[model samples]
Target: MKKTGIAGFLLSVCLLLAGCTSQNVDTTPVWQQTLPQTGVQMEVSNCTLENSGPVYYAMDRVDTDYWTEKTAVQVEGVPVVTLYGVDPEEVELRFVENVSYLYIYYDKVMPQPDLDYVLTETNDGALQYRLDTVYNYEFVITTEQGTDSMMVICHRDSLESANTGTT
Candidate 1:
């Protein structure tokens, strides 16, 4: 009986170690911000989100599989950047998470400064902009169950600090 108990303990320890090792570690940096309008948390990577800047534009609505804007739009970026998006009433509880790709389509949106990217024309004649060198990055979201994957789209301009004085 004692031998059986010892074997069981060893087996449990081995299983625990295996589980720990099997989990993948995500090194990507995620900058999160809670919208003051609705008190919702927006988790994202590849950029920074801010509330205190000239209100460039706001997140208008989200469809079944896409997040879009209401008025015209713009996305300025580099390998890293500061982004601004306001208006939480329309956004409701549509918080951004696990976004792996961000697509910005603004009417007559201006070009990106300090970044090297080209604008492409879609098959439908709408302009598609590639504002960053890294196009499709990965986002790992660890939930209570496990890690979940998601895609992303967002934009911003530089400011001093988060929710600080305006630019």
Candidate 2:
């Protein structure tokens, strides 16, 4: 009986040690290192959700798969970030978690000094602006409690030059 008890203790210790020895760790960078050369790109948005509705935000550089997480009944107002961009189409803001009722507004002109651009209102109440040259535009989103904003930039000049192979 003593021998059986001793064997059982040994087995339990081995199992505990095995569990301690294995762990899953994710080690990935939080941001893309190289900038896209010739495309409309927006940096990942970092903001908080307020008013219990949809708003613009992003997860950290790591674990940015916002679509994978189950929707929460109530977001805890944590600062999250998401990276999204487009080359030509008007940029769209996506609120990763709770987004049933988010609203966004775009500035009429590009934010850069001495830059002139125009924004046209779309049928869906969103604004659409096409970039003829490399430019950055600033926009804002608001929820019930507060508002957050981000910048969208397009590198169309680079793309045009690349296609022409002149620069």
Candidate 3:
């Protein structure tokens, strides 16, 4: 009888613990929506932040397995998420308290002139995820493929100030 009672107690405890287990729920803001494809896929769900998660970087393959390996550096080989239709202003709302970072992924081998609107790169004979020029809160990440790169932008004056001192 005691054996059965102990087993019952253990079973109940196990069931209770399992029920309390946490789930991996996505907490993306509702205002955040998919970006229209301009050569890039239109899925905001694919859009992620360095602070929120790890971004995969592969200089050779876009295979699911490769991305699963987990890399945080700039992509040099495959896949980039874009915020095409979403304006910087709309993005500003998401990072009000958090750091305002932007990852602009260009799916092409952009020439220096082509990026003049945002940045200017050195004439070095090699291309990589690099940025040079105006915009103190922005970063550029390039991939080796003929398409797709990511640019991370930070709007300090506007959103950085939104940080509240409270815990």
Candidate 4:
């Protein structure tokens, strides 16, 4: 009877300890943190940050497992994220804070210069377009082959201060 009582007491203590030891887990994504400005290639979730000289871009292999990757670059100091893979028909950009100006780039096949517009071409030959004043910026890019989506996170409060700038 004493052994049974001791066993029951031990079991109760173990149960209490187990309940007290439960850990609070964070389900938040890791990319929301302050990313390294060193431009070194690193892994975040299923994506990889790729380095090219002084610039760094995020690449995910979800578009094609074999030889293709969806790539994105945060526009320096400005609160902008440019995603590139193939020719995108539609693209949306989002930030956690209030976004003032959102830009979408639709590449024209010919190098025709329009006198009234400012065009910034990416390294992958994609033309840029500006979408003004969005409160909740959620960006999505759709191509003929597939659709790639990304979230533009501002690591700092001052990141959204300027319409255009690079860190």
Q: Candidate 1: TM-score?
A: 0.20
- Once fitted onto the true fold, the runs of candidate 3 whose alpha carbons sit more than 4 angstroms away are 21-31, 38-56, 59-167
**How does residue 129 of candidate 3 score in lDDT?**
20
What is the descending TM-score order?
4, 2, 3, 1
By descending lDDT, how would the candidates be arranged?
A: 4, 1, 2, 3
Between prediction 1 and prediction 4, which has the larger TM-score? 4
Give the TM-scores of the predictions, in the order they appear: 0.20, 0.25, 0.21, 0.28
- Select the stronger candidate by TM-score from 1 and 3: 3
Q: Write the per-residue lDDT of candidate 4 for residues 1-167, one digit (tens) a residue.
A: 99999999999999998985452323222233222332222212211222212211222223222322223333222222233343333543333221122232222221122321123455765434322222222345554545444433222333431222333
lDDT tens digits, residues 48-163, model 1? 43322222222222432455322111122432321223221222111222222322222233233324333333354322223343232222233333432222333345422121
Candidate 4 stretches with Cα past 4 Å from truth are 1-76, 94-119, 127-136, 155-167
lDDT value, candidate 1, whole model: 0.32
- Which parts of model 1 have CA positions greater than 4 angstroms off? 1-29, 47-52, 55-167
Comparing 2 and 4 on TM-score, the stronger one: 4
Worst 10 residues of 2 by lDDT: 70-79
RMSD of each: 18.7, 22.2, 18.8, 20.4
The digit string of per-residue lDDT tens for model 3 on 89-156 reads 22211111111132222223332422322211224321122222122112222222222233233222
Q: Model 2: which residue pairs collide?
A: 54-99, 58-80, 58-81, 58-82, 59-81
